[model samples]
Target: MYLRLMYLSSLINIILSFNITDYLYRYEYFDQSETTTTKLESALIKFQEFYNLQVDGTLNNDTIELMSRPRCGVSENPSEFYTYGNKWTKNQLFWYFAMADATMLKIANRVFDIWQNYTNLNFIYSIKNPDIIISFSDNIFVHKNNPRCMKGECLFPFDGKSGVLAHAFAPRQNKCIEIHLDKGEDWYIGFNKTPLAQTSLFKVLLHEVGHTLGIKHSSDPTSIMYAFYSENTDHLSKDDIEAIQYLYGKRKESSTTNTSTTTPASTTPATNTTNETNKTKEIKLDLCDIWTNKF
Candidate 1:
């Protein structure tokens, strides 16, 4: 009897958790039951289904373990993975745009600064064919059935009314990244308290930039990369930082390299061949269809 009571309490805690409870509500689990075995089982089943886990409706070890894993807003399409491998090859990447208002541009620069502070990669402001472009628009879809952007294209569109707050494309060679902000949505400049309906510009841009840097969403609720946006005070969680590091690697110490005064030796043919091979190994990604596969 004591063991059973303890189990019920544990179940209650899990059900009440923000992430789990939010998901349950989405599936129409309105009943607020603390100890009801049936309700708990049903909720667990729905949770498992959403995650593509084994739907036994029981809180098995696998379910619990999966709950702890990081998930991305982007779907794990196998073919897409093959095409847009991951990570940027160069350290200095440029972000170009004048589409947003002055206020938004200021905030965006701050976001860029934060990302650069944490990683070796940099987001330089440029006008001449930037690697990423920041733009704003509304009514992205012409018809409900057809989306303006296709698969593997780096153009991201945001219709404010659409459930999607914002979306971004992973890195691609041929196409430059285009991050779109929904013009209809109310965007807050700073951390001032705002209603649930209004979205924070800084937070959204930070997450989108993560996508551009080849980061998937994290399952950890505290992570900025999580599918849902929250009003958390922290800009980047440990998981979020780790995810970027996995792609670009940890920020290295800056030191100037001394140029060799003696450049008399010519490069061997074998050395040149190896250098060419390394450059050719660059991975290409098709971000055209990425917005359609959002989680």
Candidate 2:
């Protein structure tokens, strides 16, 4: 009877802890009843899912071990990774623009899901506004007379066809990113045949967005940010979240000191009210599309 009661109590605690790591900061006072074998298994799964750890239900030494540890795995890598050419292939050229197909939507959702699990940061996506945009010029190698690609501030890291695929601006810009659109179609993956595992342009673009958002490559092998992207690659690692959040700052109470942008909020005091009201209507483009389009 005592064992059954204990089991019952643990079951209640387990159900209540559908989201274990969400309360990571409050684990100090978490009810002990919630730490039973079954309950622990459930919580551990949450932990595993969040970190992409082994998902075995059994709370073996590996699982039991990380639970007691503070999460410092977020900030391991900081370098960028890219394709060898830094230029797009034939496949991308045939398509002109990388359309938002099922694969793109799937990748976007996967990005959201991973971020939701790892961080508390806000990702404001727009319905009418594509998450990214691309810019292509006719000239190659020189920005001097190349299409819009040469215009000062056209987009960083892309000098027309200068071997730089595309450059995603820092997220703080809150605007569209640039990609060289006219690349070969051969660079793209199957015509929507398989899942997101393969090393397609869609996959590369997805990974690059992580870089633009401040996620550095990970030492962990399973990560999308790993040095060499592959077909079977999974989502971001806990390290990826750590790196990204570090760049954008973490979940903290709102403060005025850090709230303001470089241009003071009072710059256009007379027109400020009008601009603020109009801000809602402005649609921002996505970084992935812009950068990948160039490449």
TM-score of each: 0.56, 0.36
lDDT of 1 by residue, 1-295 (tens): 8746644554555456536544454334434455366777877775666546788987676676544332223442221221236677887777754333334555566677677777777666654456776555455522111122233323334433323466667887644666655655666655456444456777778877878878765546677766556667348888778777677778776712211111111112110010111111222224442233221
Which consecutive 10 residues in model 2 have the weakest lDDT in total? 267-276
Local distance difference test, candidate 1: 0.54
**Local accuracy of candidate 2 as per-residue lDDT tens digits, 1-295:** 8746644554554455434433332322124445666665665555455445688865554544344322211222122232111222111111112334333333344444454444444433332233334223332422322232224534222222112233343232323333332231223332243332112545455555565455544546566665333555656666666665554445445421221111111111110011102111223355553442342
Off by over 4 Å in 1: 1-73, 76-84, 141-159, 255-295
Off by over 4 Å in 2: 1-99, 127-167, 172-175, 179-182, 185-198, 218-221, 248-295
